[model samples]
Target chain A: MILNDLSELAARIPDGAKIAIPPSRSGVAIAATHALIARNARGLHIVAIPTSGMQADMLIGAGAVQVMESAGVTLDEQGQAGRFVAAVKAGAIRLMDSTCPALISGLQAAEKGVPFLPMRGLIGSDLLKNRPDYKVVDNPMADGPDPIVLLPAIQPDIALFHAPLADRRGNVWIGKARELMTMAHAAHTTLVTVEEITEGDLMADPLRAPATIPAMYITAIARARGGAMPLALEGVYEADSAALAAYANAARTAEGFAAWLADAPGIAAA
Target chain B: MEYLPEELLICTITRLLEGTGHIAVGVSSPIPGSAALLTRALSNGKTGVTVLNSANLQTLNDGAGELFDRAAQGRIGAFFLSGGQIDGQANINLVGVGQYPQQDVRWSGSFGSAMLYYLVPRVILFREEHTRRTMVDQVDFISAPGTSPPEVYRPGGPYALVTGLGLFHFDKLRARFRLTSIHPGHSLEEILDNTGFGFDYEGEIPITPTPEPDRLSLLRGPIAAEIADPYPKFAAAIFKS
Candidate 1:
């Protein structure tokens, strides 16, 4: 569809939906994110995957999500990664000890219409047995196999991506991706926001557009600037320093984060 | 024929440590521990290894990760890691079975092996096995890319791999493994036999340099921080049967 502005698109992300966003500090998806903000919905559980350190904190600060991150990373400008660790510790959000591959496998299994994907890597870790959300299933196929694998399904309702370049038809491209494409491909519904929108078919460019994110899978696209983090590119900018600071403060204070979110710009429940 | 296996491992590590302004190592990694220990104990703690204060890094130090924070702005120089499967170009995937897609892996590592290995230049690859499976025909996955071709890697590919048998370096001139030296009892044929692929080479592998008792103790006690990728569950799963 021809999305002229952010407001027209933000309406699509209804609240109470399981949403997934990219992990890049360069913020391409912010317009769609701004659009989500325009929705002013409540109880929207945002699943923060792939991102490291500061960007995860930005999402949390905006009150766009209750963060679910595997690791914490301090940004180029910070003293340390924001208090996602603290939030998890306080039970404000859930954390998963993830491997990009395993997360992809689980997501793909969920998206491909499978019940779960068997992963041998996470078999006996404290993460599996402790996290009630992750089910440890006995492999029926393991009938007699000694080291049987389990399954992980239940993908997010929406997988949002921020790309360097995308077309009107919603074909997306990210080169040498660090598992971003894997997560997008495995998501149930994929939405991409990019730095630039091209006129020629995404198929025309061989080096950049080796493979296209087919339109059938895409929900919508938006052309927002500062899309890459650390810069105001046709892509997103780097993690919002303001948002990060707010998150850090909230992580330390005795007051619940809701009060902190009251001051930030995120989706407001009407 | 100067240093023994331990000496060679320690000295080669010391050289890499020299490159690192502020060195860091994860837990349970013997080589990383030895390097830090060698630097302080053997090198008289005079080496330029910056002691970052990021708390996670401190867990290995004395219950503080604050040491990791100190290394943030390229302040920390280098680190070490081990790998089960490494390709011709040094990329590590310690996470799992490439053959099977459906197995649950515990604590899929604390991330950053690929991230750090790709981004960090002076990575020391230390694996106990210098054999076929460990030095594979081809890695099941491209966990990270090595010195991306003729282009000089700034903060890049591995400096060395100290296996139980030998020390291997990727000769940037040819972009392949050249046996600089070997442990006391090993030979070029034994080293070559253990390798999954063959590369350009010379007649003999030199003996690896080791550290003295006082030096070794320094590594074990004062200078070196213990390297541990603590996954108590990995032990549980291995022993389950």
Candidate 2:
């Protein structure tokens, strides 16, 4: 289904929904995120595709997140994610600290419809001890005693992201961001905001089909021009460093963050 | 013929990455990314360089999971990792300080370090900050352990540690870092004073070699322009003439 506006898409993501979002470098649904915050959405469980950045920070700062599971959350060159740090320090949100591959493995298991997937590493690391769900067991194939970590499948309630293009049929052209496909496959529903909605079919073209996610996986699509502002969309545009730097500076304090959020272009209007 | 400290670090890192096949650099790593690009430039494109999140640099098509998959297959030769607190045993703590869940300080979670540290053949532990607070006797949490048990399926671990003060190689068998060379302006006393963890050092530690004139020219020239794509601020600040 095609949503009329960003808010309509945001409205689909109910409070306490387990939503999977891509990393900052990948296409991030910043506009949709703003809309969600504007609607005062709460108790969101964010599952970062391995890792995340400003989008996650903003959501956490807005008190929209109850749980955050990821390998890391950083602002890249901008500096530390102040809001996330503050939240973690305050014990505001439950953090499921995981390694990058472990998250991917869990998601892959869900995509493959498996109960769990066995992975190497994480033997003596503290991450294993902290995570009760991850179990270390002897590999049955090994002649000797070989220990490996088993990760349970992670199936999110929704997969949300932004992309460069999508068709009227809800097929999304992700280009090189294949992780979105993994997220879409691992989630119960996938929502996307795109720069433009083409009239024709995106999957019909041979060249574009390879990089396009079929509409079957996508639950809804919303046309959001420049949706990934402040964050880059790979081939579409470069990241606005000055804006990101401003956000980084303003998000340092709760008051500053609130002020910044209120003054943000779309949030006030929303 | 003068060079910046970043250039020196890049040169040192480039030398360490001399014979490695494909070098993969993580996010927020300008110095290592520059060095990997430099190594590739020096090798005339023989060495593969994959800088995560760079449109121009990344060659992977299968997305984020491919990097880990390649590492598991032993395709990635070298990788870089850093920590909030590194111990004598080379255990890195990217999680936070104090206790596990409720900690006083929290840096970014353990990125790909846990797997990459174990998968990548040569994992260079890089931290620009060298202090007692950053380097500890034992980490509050082991994000990625320095060494695994003998029966564990581990092929890669910490190869060396590079800081602003000096360079130290990790002895995995002994599970300790040995002081290899101190940077030109730094001293053994300074290192000993600043470091919270103990290390092995023999007789007189040699000063780390500065970047030669040719290497400096390359760093200030094509390499600087190339690195500007991913880390424009760093390139502009360091290479601004």
Candidate maximizing DockQ: 2
Q: Where does the lowest 10-residue lDDT sum fall in candidate 2 chain B?
A: B232-241
The digit string of per-residue lDDT tens for model 1 on B53-90 reads 22223322211212332332344457776765765666
Every model: Cα RMSD to truth: 16.9, 1.5
Expressed as tens digits, the lDDT of each residue in A115-167 for candidate 2 is 99998788889999989999999999989999999999999999999999999
Best by lDDT: 2
lDDT of candidate 1 over A19-135, digit per residue (tens)? 765444323355465456546644455554533444455454445555354422334233433344344434555444444434545556766788776543333333344345555
Which 10 successive residues of model 1 chain A have the least lDDT summed? A229-238
C-alpha lDDT of all candidate models, in order: 0.52, 0.91
What are the models' TM-scores? 0.49, 0.97
- Tell me the lDDT of model 1 at B17: 67
